[model samples]
Target chain A: MSSGEAGWEERSVARIVPPIRPRKLAKVPFVELAEGRLQGVVSSGSSATRVYVSSIEAETHDFNCSTNNNRPCGGAQGSFHCKHLKALIDEAVKQYGLERVARYLKVEAAEGDDLHSLLNGKLVKAPAAVVFSRFLRHLTYLKVPAGSEPLPEMHWFPALKAVH
Target chain B: MQGVQLAELVQTPPGVDEAMEAVAGFDAALADGLSRLGPRHSEAVDALAGAVSASPLGAAAADACGELAVGSISDTELSALAGARAALLGAVHDALLARLDGALGRTRAEWEEHPADAQEPPANLLAGARSWLRELAIAGWRGVDEELVSAADQTLEALWAEPRLRRLAVLLDGLAAELRVSCPVATMERIPERRWADLWTRAVLLAHSGSWTGGAAAVSGRLLPLGVDVHEHGTAVQAQLHAVLEPRGDGPVRLVRAAVAAAKVDTIVGPEVWDLLSGHPTLLAAIAERRAVDIADMPLTADGDLLWDEERAKAGEPADPFATARVRLPDAEAPAVAPLDRHPVRIAEPVLVEGYKAKRDGTFDLGGAAIDVDADRLPPSGPLTPQLVNASTACIGLLRWDAGRWTLQPLAVRSVAKKQPVEAHNGDWALGPTDPKAAKALARSGSAVAVLTERAGKLLRK
Candidate 1:
């Protein structure tokens, strides 16, 4: 498992495409992916978001909108893509390496009429390094603010040493 | 010249000529007796009426006799005169027959010359009078012909009771209405009583035989209104009425058959037509049998509602597993309603039990019922194991009725959780651990062993 993680690091040298930043991956608190099984992105912060996936058919993507918002969705009305879906794809690339991520995203291109031709270039050019860096950043605990005061040390009593 | 010499030699009184003179004399006597009748003339008037009905030529003379009988004709002298009048009337009837024979001969001669014109359609002709000439040429007179029997019988009675020219005219009018023709009133009045009776009987029989075809039945539809006693005619007439509905026929007959099959016979009749259908029990039973067979072939549910039975769920078998027929209830002593499909309720404990069906589609069969397990309704651990061909554990779910079968909608699947048993020592003995081996070792030692429920702690001590 550790070697597989190293392999993902080795392949993540390319740059991320425009409009989607590595910082956005930090904003996504959690991601889960399984081949032909499950794909999800979850965040428990102020801006709550989730994307549950099973099949990657066009009709199945329409269901994702119904699951979250009780409406049909085809990325119409200038809503070109789902943010959570992108987050899930990026996190899968970070965890599973470029080869698995390319296969997973292959479904998106095959099912979407406009995306298939465009996604080939994006998949080949996407930087796995940026995906890993953003994923690792979220795993670290929250840091204390630099201006916070330090705690005072406690003094031990000398009489207790002999009693032991 | 030979014909003229024969005619000159025949100077003696001819029989027909003499009979005509006698008829004239009887008419004069009947008028005289009627004008001066006393109580003694009753028997003679009755005798005269009977005699007039019996003889073909005396029919006209019988008219006056009937009128005198209704009048105040009386006295022994008048009675003697009535007998004389009746004898004269009989002679007149013979003369009338001779006159009819002569007319028929003349008509045949006319037909021989212009055959088609002689037998023209009898528009506005009397039913009894239109074919008088032709009938005379063929049969001579009315009584000898088999076809004239019923007409002769009925006409004799009708003329006897009301022997007047006007009354005879009315009866001929009735016959003409049925025949749809007009006749000269004089010819109708002269028609023998037998011919009138025969016409009525023929019309009725023709109507009765029209059971198979709707055409004649439509014309015969008026029989019930005419006071015809059809039921008395036996099975032949009743069969015609009963089978008004045809089995293989089309149009009106088919429609009538469908209606009769669906309705009870008693409900189909009105009070007006009851007399025509009253005496036939066999006909009703036959109709009921036909109805049962027809209903059996219809696509119907056990409750008698028509439906298509499609076995969509049970492979090639029927979706309904229960018998759909009505069963007799022993306790109630009546027929029970059709039974519905039912299944045994599943009692699955939380513990994993074998013998339940599980599938990868997240479905199972419990107690012979198909069940769907919803992901949301399942426990957080989901299924602890992949579906086993021979399942040893089960989870209880709700039993639902759907499409004539019971289905189970699973709420949760029982999971397998391993339990760890702890062992502790009590003095020299190993105690109350669920380990069977430790307990067995102590048993083999033959030394007294104490079992502690918890870590060898002191009991009842401060």
Candidate 2:
């Protein structure tokens, strides 16, 4: 597309799009745990997108996103965002490549969760690229002690990188 | 009787016997003077003139002769004699009058000076007057006239002239009569009769010995006549009787022994032995033994049942009614999640993008936007996660978002590729290693190429 057309098309794309779903590949991996009486599942999609698993004992979490269809999505019924959703998204990105993880990093993914929604779709811009460049420099320079657990999943790092 | 006789003696007639007794002794002195008579007179005549001057008859004759002598004289001779006599008599009378006047004046002066001593009867004069009046009043002397009363009044007045004498006479008279008794000694006798009687009564009361008889009689009337004196006998008698009659201390112990003895008596003989046991000893033993019997032998009625019911009712009283039950909570476990990395995240000093501008010349611009990173600017010690990244970046990032309207994300880079001249250009753009070479080549040819670096692209997509 022409540059002007591209900008116009991006604005239109932003308005019309609902959230993209993670594409199915070969197999999805998952972990099981319990909180109170409810059991939870932490899983990775075929594209290494993270998803959460839960079943109702009394009430369900709003950000639960788990389904019998094996395709992770949103809409559940609890007051607060669920930890299962967070675990699913974080594990998906860490295990898979960033390009394959884009579908899960959509604006809607970070909407209920506090972190990754900050980036949204601003990655195509030059200024956003520069900011991402700076953030990469920061990540490369970051020193983590050996044998330590990885950092807890949060959305703001990439979002801040997009803004620079 | 003597008081009556004395009263009679005082009332006896006063006559010439008093006058004759008054002249009798002076007649003997007159006769002796006549024996020593003057020479010109006959002895008989001298004796007769002296006798006339001294005897009772002679005293009367002398009065007549003195009148004759005055009568026979001539007027001038009598006048001269009378004048001389009158002058002599006047001189003697004047001297005597002066003496009497001095004494009477002294007496009156003392009377006036101590008027109470003079006017009022001395305490002693009152005592004497009280005695005399008491005696006269006791006697039948109803009509003593004012003259006699005046004489008695004058006598009391003279006696009362000296206070000491008046007091002494009062004290003496008081002693003489039992009507008003004096104290043990005279000076202390001045207490009034009422006060004296009170003192005497008090002294008698304090003696105490006389009232003991009456007190004993009163006590004896109440207690001694009763038969309770049997308990007052010696302790040995009580002990001996107690040993023979009731040998043990407790009622049940004595009752059991008496029951055993009674059983033995009944066992030895039949109804005849029981009849022999009908006297006082048997009655008292039976009474004493009755106390040892258990209540099981007694008949029960509604009254007994009520008493027992009351005791049982008291024992089963209900416990406190307002007690509260305790509530127990079920155990709950915390959700299991992956633990956060304990390693702290360190952010270095940020590159100053504004002040170090890309210039055509070698010099850097100091006025452009600057970035400063301080490690101290990090939030206080707590969970360090990627969430803190934006919070820290926003502190230094001069950016704004239109809240609730547009979610615009601003980039931190500025385009400086155009400002670079061809002579100095080693590469067309300053994009880092993650950028594709084709884009770099395109940018070197003065074309706008979108540069994508692997790390930068990954962060953007996330």
Candidate 3:
């Protein structure tokens, strides 16, 4: 670290939570902070077409892990997190960094508290239908070919008034 | 094309052909989109309108030249002088540049997509263009000979007919069109310096003409590494490393480019480019990889580009660029707002902008004004990483007006000054031997490029 990095960390970051650890690569392919939740799809280790839709709710730390078809995971039981649910958290940390994920989840993290340490007791089961449907809809975008022709769906995204 | 609403450019990302399509019906679009753009920037359009739409000045120049003709002049002959004066007026230059940008980018993308078609410049065609230029140069003020003009036109027309060659052929044909005008020549210069230089820069870039050394000067600075580059001139493939520097003495901020050319017949953008660099000097490797260096006195261009002369320029010390008191970002000047021409330029204003915010869209959210970037044209490189919006507070770059908003092609970026600032780029790579493997990949190189440099060339010449 250069001499000013310590001070830069202080200035560039808001002190809402302890500075997050440097994030690593995604443990799973997809993760995002949308629908007021840290949620995305994770591929199944043993199955090819099979994907587990996982999410941790923003407000309640309510967690859900199930096959896209609603079959519940064997690992996500009681207070323990399955690998898919943990992968979702890991990827969220990678995407938004540790501090943002902690802040968004309303985790009270102190200095040197890794993500898992901060979110120790804040999880419970939640319905997975909304997230799974959203994931299915999200997969539809992958087929959207690159082009400039006004898209039918995009037409509803009101044209912003021209910048003067 | 009319200058877009700056906000519109920022808010609307192009859908591939958005800018091109909009520019196609530029005049009508301008009338509908923006009634009035900057009058100063309209010089090209106005001049072009005058040139094509029967200009009184062009008529006068034509009439003056028409009388001096030793024989009868054709309609084609008369229009040549007039059109050159009125300009395409800048449209030819703009269209040529845009096409070149698109073509090269497309070719590169295509190669990335389908590596099978990274075809070498069809040598004979390039040779034809080269011969046409040489013939034009030989003809000089006396005006190009008719036979040569006829032959070159045949070749140029064929070049134009080919879709792949269209972009590269634009400048060649443009120069041919300028050279072959049937109007009688006098001792006076025909084209303006701006047009001449503009054509020259694009032409050299297009042709990849090999090696031209600039006048040398004793220069020194706390060289902040900016970008790495590579280009293939006809005879040689050159690798260049660029840096922005603060002079050792009291002077304005300047840029330094260190370049080396290898006599190679292979394509510069080939698979084994690094292997070729492997045997070159340490500095060439450093050029291949943008590296920060601290130097006392080095032989460089008046603009501060390090010369190829090994005995003159000392190999600089490897150091971290961000370990500094401050980072300077010269306020880049935008040409009069012209929609047709992006008029991209490296920054010029002596200004330090700190505490600005970077956005996910590759723009620095400088309060009300935001500078946008196109991942296609200028991907955030060096210290301006993929996470620039999250990482750095300040960005250094080439500035241009695209669509409507002022855009920046980022060169370098760094954290804040209040702390141990971290730059996305530094000179740590130069500590190793000159084996070329140390050079960061995706680096750019050039030949006969010193004449076409952005920030440094402009500053020193002034």
Candidate 4:
């Protein structure tokens, strides 16, 4: 599509989901695991997607997508874009502005010992990614420890190289 | 002599003293009536009939005269005299009963020690209650006759009906149920009347204690979680605890024992309870001994210090409560503010002025610019127009540097008149200036801003 056409199309797509829809994702079950990683699940009827997001990196994530009458996507070859991933990304963008999410990704990719403090400071400005991940984690059925120190052997999201 | 006295006693006028005396004399006469009348039945009967004929209570006496006129004191005539004597005795007994009934006003302890000495059965409800309570205090629950038990049951039922007394009744009922399960009658018999009285007194005191704030006030602490069937009776449990736990002579021993019992039942009580229990030095020592036994497996010196001083070393620095107030050494100097190396300034660009402040003068600061706001650009009333206030994006403006000062001049303003950006879950954009109708459409769709934004961004790229 042409840039103007694309913009129009984008506007049309944005109109599809109400402003409240992304906010309602806050009600989703998710857990903040050890090292600040997140694990969650989202399902519609029998179709479900288990999402894992990285602790130190925002772009790095893996999802197990299963839909009716379709082969399950478990990061195998040709497993790229899925509706679940799109839903999660949409929620993150709406909850956090595009600019804020971009900044968060940049911050996460950069290496620093004071990353935790930095994340906390930046969270006030750009809370969408954290909130989105947390929402996802909340939707998950996995037992998550609360208020306790990080446990050893905590799992992290496997980096997927090919997801669009 | 008895027959003549009976004749004269029944012949007397009705006065308080005279009636009492006559009743007493009649009682003595009736006792010997049959025996005295064995040989002189007719003569005795004649004397009684003549006396009763002149008396106020003479119905029975008059009936006897008919039998005597026939030259015989028949069984029916004897029966009549017996009935008259009983009626007189009842009147006297009622007076005595009323006097005894006044004893109910005395304290329970006094009643227990000094019960009323009534010759006949109680003539009123209060009299009966006092008699029953007195007997109960001495003989325990076993001493409770059917009349007393029924009274007790009725009292419980009445209490159950009342809101205030219902709590005590419920607690008593719970205890009774528990007693039935654990020890039946055996354990209950061991509870003396004094203990029962004390329990009741304590319960009342506790119920009215008016919001006690002691350290161990977690009232249910371990009891609730362990499924320890605490009496759900309102406030009775606390009252019970106050009675049983608060006034123990050996406070610590009592507390530790309670703790031990709770521990045996797999309950971990809070520290406040221990503080109350261990308030005394002797109890503290006992607790210390028990705690020592608990931690005996750990490696420690005879003085109870850890074998390794690593924890003390790891403590790094001991914080003094009055550290700031401590005397400073002479070498210390006062703190100073650091000077900035350069003046803070930003290049000319279209920027969104998020906030503005009015200085002492009426001029406004447009994004930190110390310049006067154009009156024409200002709203008719209030500080700024709603269009400017509501705009999410920066209006096209030039940040100019003139005379070593920053000033902003607006070339054009962007108004979000048609579309208002809805805040997403993360306080981000639901709709932006790029999509004027996006917010309206998204609102119609009834989804979140974040979700719409993500999907729309993808659509734009596609």
Candidate 5:
């Protein structure tokens, strides 16, 4: 039990003993480059380690990733890049440790590429900019609030949309 | 020359004179036959014309003549008659005209003054008069008005009746009026009494058959006015009346009873009552077996009230003995040491015992030796042992051992047992196991022989 506690301490060591100067960026207002719409507010509380891109015009494609390219071009087959993904990554890095955020982003990027490829030609084709625009409008009408920042980015978003 | 003379005589026969004379003779015979047959033919023509003019046959003949004139009559006889009447009337007119110098007016006037009456009656006198004329006019008539005669005939037949039927009609009209006033409908028509009776009877029958609502009440109420006592007479009368009125089938006694039972009335009538009465013979049986009877009122005597008061006063008197006190004995307790020689202890009354124990202070343990005796039969000892002193008492004698021997003592006694030789035995033994050793010892002592015999008998039976 002592060793297990020590191991937990080691894994959470950075969180308990935060770095003297944690990487951070200034809080920025989220904006869709194409639509010039004020989408939401973004803060660099803990998710400054990774880059995140969000779009009010293209909700389905908006995403957070290690790289600036939201699309998983190399291997992102069935990826769901959305404002929620961006918000979650930002949340996870801010609330939890950056190491977990980085690890989470990498795994999510690989899984997203695989899913994108698998469902490329199916009825549930990845929503490109055009479909994303429609989805964004729908979400805007529904008024779905922004998700928590620094979310666990390693969690895979299922390709299945709303069943109904 | 002689031949000439004979020829001259024959020559004279071939002259115009001889031919003229022969023609004149033949004309005269023809005229005579014509005169005779012409009058008879004229008479026949006159007779036929009169018949045709005066009777339906005359009209027919006239019509036949007109039809013949227009080439419509094809019958030979009718055609001949028409031709003959035409000729006769024409001849008569012509003759009259000749006599009146061809003045048609004068001739018509003379005929009108003395109109021709044939020797025989018209051929269709009965058929040709007003009846036939009317028939002719009606034959050509059209429209529903043509049925007026037939309609009138039907109306008359429908309205016709015997005196009894008329009376019935009157009664029915009156009854219908009454019914209308009593139980009116929207539309009122004076229905005959027989019809009303029939309707009422039918309604009642339907009610009996369970066809109408409140039919039983309606029937009974209606029947009551007719002097029918449904409840008293039973359903039989109602049923018979129903059969008399409507003769359809048996009255619905069952339905009526069910209805009456539903109504839960003291008295019911009509079919419902009949139904109940007929179905439940138990009702009649209960009535027959009714046993409750009312007591008659007591008659008042001159001194009845006074006597009753005196009796009551005597009963209210107080009893002679005011109060009573009962003294109970204490129960017997076992002694620590059994008496060497059993001395019979007599208990005059029941008692309650406390407990048994020896006393202190060098004195004998009298707790177990205290004995209570009757005050009247107090022993010489001062107090009785505790074993004898079964329970507490206000007045009693107590005995105790001064040295170590059993003694007798007396206690206060409210009463004592009337019998002598009061038996004393160990209450424990009396209530506990029947030991044969004790029994033999008792038998040897020759005490309680009856108890021993009973115990022996009980052991034998076991």
Candidate 6:
């Protein structure tokens, strides 16, 4: 095709994509690897009032599952990675990608190991409040109405302002 | 005068520090002053005229202010006034920035802790970019109000609060200021409508620079030959070699992008990206060979992209990035603090979208987020379109907010290429090997006057 006649795929053939796609699903909407922990909010499958805040602390690998108000999860009593935390990782892989989740959690992957397999990190107790609040802050963005007018407060995040 | 000059020399020479220090207080003062104005009225117009008369502006401002005093101004005209005011401030910023730079005598202990800092592009590299227009005899905007050399104030203030963006915004302000001083007498018909759009984008890149420069680091990986993404910025064609860097060891996975920008000449720059890669044989050979290798001793910019200078690198063993099936790609993250819909930086967010289905509306939807294709920035018919056409698996690209929706300009595809499942692929097309086609496609965007390079020579000779 001629210049402007380029098809969509052929057109997008060159865009400065970020290193990779974010690896999280909508089920566990807000996940971030931050402050020595892999933490985020996993939406409640049954009750919206009791969304779970799950976290896995780096180095210690200490994991926690609780409500937004710090109530403990019955499924996460022991040192095992619970379903909520697993879901968080699953989405984290979608949002952040699997490799970054392993690196931040410092997982030494053997050949053909799922994120859970071949990992030697312990689970310990930590607060769920901060991660929950962070998720709440993240939710605020979805409320912003789309418009052509630019927001004065809206600029590229300094953190992502790579040379690219 | 000599005696006065000799007395107690205060080292106040507008250096980088002074320019940076001045930035902290201007926004608050601007906000305060704006608050005092309350609302725009007939009186407000007269007061603005008075302010323009009192300010150190040229004759054009007086003429525009006089016109505003006679009749009610429209919204665009009002914005023009604000833009010109902002531009005047930017001119001041430019003056201070230029004065402060290059005068520090190149010796500072607090900064430049690294010896490689010398290679850092001088802070004032493009600070005075507006000067180019005057030298080249190019026309610049003078605002709808006929206010001298204006940029949209709302657009400028949106970025003015950010120190990094502030540095750039101030320089842009100066750019408008420079234009005003250089050619202040443009007629009302000569002022283009929405002139600031091009200025906003051009000045953003020209004035601001990355924090990290002049440091070499080695990273080895299987360079997934994703694709070459290109953008036509003014007279320049910016092409990026987008790839996935699967580590030689257990290092974190990185999305590597090596950029090659060139001028768009009179002729077409062939259809393929392969011709662009021929300049750097190391990267081209590795991509063409399609093997795992050690890419060593490359300059790392602050934003984490390794500059591909066709120098110092080695080779390594093969490794698969998809062994784990899922990738938690490192850094350049989506704004965690805001929802994707409301995230301010969504305008510049880098996205890797997967599991997205093509909609009948000619858009792609991942879960619920809609992505339209930006048709302007695409390569000419030759390369790969990514996961859309084939197996429609996944793709790497940038996401930009345009019109009213998010537009996707994909760079690479991990789908079925040539009837085989390939992880990362650009396309089947490559430009000529440094021949006429290759030279046509690639011209350095960093070096200004992409279109005028040839035309300018003839203009100057006259």
Overall lDDT per candidate, in order of appearance = 0.25, 0.22, 0.41, 0.26, 0.22, 0.41
Fraction of native contacts (fnat) of each candidate: 0.00, 0.02, 0.00, 0.01, 0.00, 0.01
Question: What is the DockQ for all candidates, taken in turn?
Answer: 0.00, 0.01, 0.01, 0.01, 0.00, 0.01
Most accurate candidate by lDDT: 6
- Which lDDT tens digits does candidate 5 get at residues A1-164? 11133222111001111111111212322222223111322333455433333322222332322223234322122445443434534533433344433332223333223322221121123223433332223222112121111111000000010110
How much is the lDDT of residue B41 in candidate 2?
21
Cα error of candidate 5 at position A49, Å:
26
lDDT value, residue A121 of candidate 2:
21
Worst 10-residue lDDT window, candidate 4 chain A: A151-160
TM-score ranking from best candidate downward:
6, 3, 4, 1, 2, 5
- Model 3: per-residue Cα lDDT over B1-462, one tens digit each: 012222333343323233223222222212211123244323332333334445444554444234323333332332343233324324432443344233222111110111223446566665666555444433432443445555675555445444445334444544444333322233323222223323433343344421222234566656655554333321123344555566678755654455543332111222223334433355543443444455566655433346444443334655333332134322211112122112222111111234666677666566666655423222111122355435676654433333223444444456655678655432222233232432333222232122112212322222
lDDT digits (tens) for residues B1-462 of candidate 1: 012222232222245344333433333233222444445444444444444455553554455455555652322223333334434423433333233223222111110111111222222222333233123222322222324322332332222222122112222323432222112122222232222222222222212211111110211100000000011000001111111111223322110111101101110111112222223232222221221112112221221112211121011112110011101000111111111100011111011112455666655544443344422222111121222222324443322221112233332233333643211111011012233553443344222111110101221122
- Given the true complex, what DockQ would model 5 score? 0.00
User: In candidate 5, which residue ranges exceed 4 Å CA deviation?
Assistant: A1-25, A29-40, A43-98, A102-164, B1-462
**Across residues B201-226, which tens digit of lDDT does each residue of candidate 2 receive?**
22122121111100000000000000
lDDT by residue (tens digit), candidate 1, A48-114: 3422221122222321311232233333222234454454455544444444444434444332233
Model 3 bad stretches (over 4 Å): A1-164, B1-224, B229-240, B244-253, B259-306, B323-354, B377-392, B402-405, B413-423, B426-462
Error of 3 at A11 (Å): 39
**Candidate 2 CAPRI assessment class:** incorrect
With candidate 5 superimposed using the best TM-score fit, by how many Å does residue A51's alpha carbon deviate from the native?
17
Candidate 2's DockQ: 0.01
TM-score of chain A of 2: 0.25
Candidate 3: Cα lDDT at B92: 32
Can you write out model 3's per-residue Cα lDDT over A62-117, one digit (the tens) per residue? 67788777888888876678899888787666545666678667787664566664
- Give the distance in Å from residue B235's predicted Cα in candidate 6 to where it truly belongs: 4.2
Best by TM-score: 6
